[model samples]
Target: MTLVLKPLAEQVMVITGASSGIGLVAAKLAAARGAKVVLVARNDASLTEAVEAIRAAGGDAISAVADVGDIAAVRAAAAKAVGHYGRIDTWVNDAGSAIYAKLVDTPLDEHQRLFQTNYFGVVHGALTAIPYLRDTGGAIITVGSIASDLPSPILSAYAASKHAVKGFVDALRMELTADAVPIAITLIKPAGIDTPIAQHAANHVDGEALIPAPVYDPALVAEAILDAAEHVRRDITVGGAGRLQVLLGTHFPALLDRLAGVMIPAMSDKTRPKTESTTLFEPEQRGQERSGVQPGRKTSVYTAAERHPIALRSIALAGIAGATLLAFRRSRTRK
Candidate 1:
């Protein structure tokens, strides 16, 4: 059977973690593009506010307060969306939590709690959304991190959860393909997004928690997620830095490991005071979009790559050739 893909205006999208960060941004953008949006998050007040904002801006939106970590709650949320919108065309698994501490330093329960939201939340969202999507061809976009591809020092638990998400997404994609299901399953891996995540993360370190430098705006990630809803792609890494890290980690694991060891320690600011704020146990206040901490880069190479893949490939090849020639010249001079 030939698969039919619906346009954004004709689809109903349910976004988890819709109260803040990338999920919230994606929800707003998707609504602006004419999609009926079902906003899901644990925070009822923030979810209501987000829905009202969408409505005020002349968009169709409904709120379902549910913790993605709870399978039954997520299932109910899905039912509510279907009950309200009649059907769901796109499901975005964007709910996530993090911890900033060494593996040994992290409490076992805290680590488990991180998994509940980050990894299992995606599981719950996918499991709940898949049946509906299987009946009517739709999309499942899971928001992962660049950490899925490479490990960060302080975010060990969060990194592990993302890795698990990648594994689940890959396996599910294969299953759907084998079964001849027309669902479009995509994983969006973002790196150092300028979102409220850093401020919201549970910090165990001595200094302030901050997303690493060269952060990309959450809007970039939201745009990518919305694009994936219309297009069929297996996975997309958002920032150029993230793509480079994946490539290097894959090809030069040892070198990347050494670099990470040096870079992670240097990035921490000792002067900044630390605070413990875990969205793991309870819902935090919202209304803020960006973290307001990091001054993100003006342009994203990943966005350019997405727009011009061929041109980006050509540029990469040329750069590799130039570096090889330069190295050869240096070797000759040494001889």
Candidate 2:
């Protein structure tokens, strides 16, 4: 069998959501680690800024503005990446959107929107990259929220989207392997990082705000994402909070689910509103709409992000759910 190890220096990585948050930071780190980068995002301004920063730091990079939710745009960006780098070594589906509303209160349109961005967006990336990855023997990495494993009433749609991503990515991984393709896929699940996601959250029910615990910097999650992609791990869960959730979910699912079901509601009842409509992704990325709710000030991690919150419940749910998974694995190992 011919061996094709990734060329760390000459390799190219296509990162969606590169205009901000994990996508932005992943591009920075990959370039630093010696990969030429192809950046994709909906915001042209942020894409320009991100590419300039990468070049300034002596990294090879190119930018393409696209809405991953829109299949055509995503396909066009993928084609551009192959043209720019001549070969793509990695693709990271890091684009995401989150809006809050009780499942019933949130309208169908909003849920559909989230589905387009979170679930179908990943599907689009997969469709675009699979053929290229097959040819290049490369990889695909998708961003999934802790919501996939944990349940939350208010962010039900957001969670559903992530849940769908996991199934999609996992199945894709199996198919690639079974077909004897030298391709790897990873799922990145990080606790809240202080990004603009929350401020941009659309209101579904009442204008309730989600006050997060202290969150970490977006750069933190970015590092973990690179780790997963480079190492070809199954899933990488970051933060003390996220670990806890995975643990409980693994071992004590019923208990963790009950507890989480109670906590989010109690928190939402006391939470305040932003008093305005905001966008999570930068304006250039989210159709040139100015992003409000300043960069998160979260600087701490309490089992989850400790410095700030993306959504009040995004981080905590991971810990609660993770625990059950952990516990179950422990029991199986002991057996």
Q: lDDT (CA) for every model shown?
A: 0.87, 0.72
lDDT of 2 at 138: 74
lDDT of 2 at 39: 90
Residue-wise lDDT of candidate 1 within 1-335, one digit each (tens)? Answer: 65666899999999999999999999999999999999999999998999999999999999999998899999999999999989999999999888888899999998998999999999999999999988779999999998898887888789999999999999999999999999999999998898888778888887778887668888888888988888787788889887887788899988977887776664456688865666777996564568787866647866667645687788889999999999999999999
User: Where is model 2 more than 4 Å wrong at Cα?
Assistant: 1-7, 205-208, 211-214, 260-262, 265-275, 278-335
- The residue-level lDDT of candidate 1 at 161 comes to 96
Indicate which candidate wins on lDDT.
Answer: 1
Deviation from native of the Cα of residue 303 in model 2, angstroms: 12
TM-score per candidate: 0.92, 0.79
- Pairs that collide, model 1: none
lDDT string for model 2 (71-98, tens) is: 8999899889888778888889988888
Superposition TM-score, candidate 2 onto the true structure: 0.79
